[model samples]
Target: MFPYRPMRGLDEGLYCVDGSFGRSPLGRRMTVLVLPSGRLAVHSAIRMEQADMAALDRLGPVGAIIVPNTLHKADAPWYAGRYPDATVLAPRKAVARLARRMRIDGTLEDDWPAELAAALDRLALGGVRMPEAAFCHRATRTLILTDLVFNLGVQFAGLSRLLLKLDDAYGRFGPTRLFRWVVLRNKAALLASLRELEQWDYDRIVMSHGDIVETGGKQLMRGAFASLGL
Candidate 1:
């Protein structure tokens, strides 16, 4: 397992594990949701040590594994191999790509388990080269994202910090300029999706690649996309 922090609670029935992102110190995170039925849903999974896995198992039986997008599918197979009974899920558009990495049992749009559906709201981002999905955990009003934005802060050092600074995402809560230039295909469509997300009642934002926005996330999101006139 790569260097990682042990599982820690984030909100009521919500948890996260922080770990290294490949060789970069930019970091990554895995969000864990304990459903109303006591089953666990893992989003953007990361390979963890046995102790951490045991800690996660103590929360509840792993019922679902969510690969939020193609870019975040690297660790999906690891989770699948560990929890063979867990249903692997991805966005409808991401299923085909994710299937090349692991067996995708269903899409988040239609095949999400009924028992787990009530705890969160889901959306598929539009007009991006790599299809991605976002979620809002209803009970905590936390918006969950993967690569939509980054908030690396000052934890990084040396080369990683320099690279992030070059990317214009080192110490901010916004999308990287690189992402805008490379991944985003249609600004209008992405802006439309961002507008739709504004309707969600979320105050906190938890993203895969950086620090969590504890409050005022809506305003931050708006400001982040203001350049695109959101």
Candidate 2:
């Protein structure tokens, strides 16, 4: 079975499951948001054991499954199959790409549920070739992201460690050199989006890959982008 940790609470009404990307040492995380209505919205899904699925079910019915970005669609099909009734959402620019793998009910830019809208603020990251999106959970003051930045740290070893270090993401909470050179197409557009994001009141960050930033997220995010002269 694909290895994954059971659901664990993080903040009020928020939880996460730790997993990995295929055989890679790069860690992946699935964030679960429980709306005030008790419905659940899953972000960047990971295939989990039956018991863990059961645990998720016990929390609430899965009302929405978010793909977040084009590259993060690996296990979205699995989640779509398991929660057939759940609306599958992806970034507007990613709908076509994600549709090649699974059914996409709507785009994150539009068609978001009222319950989800009430809990989180969503934004599409512009000037990036990868079609990524980011969210801020207002109640928990947490920012949710996928691939815009990485925080791999020193948890990895050997090749994985060396590669991450070379990428400039091994021991830092910032974007990799490759991400800046290739994935980032227009610094100005991304900078505008980041400026808007700065207005959000978030202290913690929950990203799909690597460890979550428990505090000082706003500062770290600003610093990450500032390095790009954005």
Output the number of the lDDT-best candidate: 1
What are the TM-scores, per candidate, against the unseen true structure? 0.96, 0.96
The segments of candidate 2 whose C-alpha lies over 4 angstroms from its true place after superposition are none
Judge candidate 1 against the unseen true structure and give its global Cα lDDT, from 0 to 1.
0.89
Name the lDDT value of residue 23 in candidate 1.
86
- Alpha-carbon RMSD, candidate 2: 1.2
In model 2, the Cα lDDT at residue 172 comes to 86
TM-score (C-alpha) between model 1 and the true structure = 0.96
In model 1, the clashing pairs are: none
Encode model 1's per-residue lDDT on 141-223: one tens digit a residue.
99999999998887778887788888999889999988899999999999999988999999999998888999999999999
The models' CA-based lDDT, in order, is 0.89, 0.88
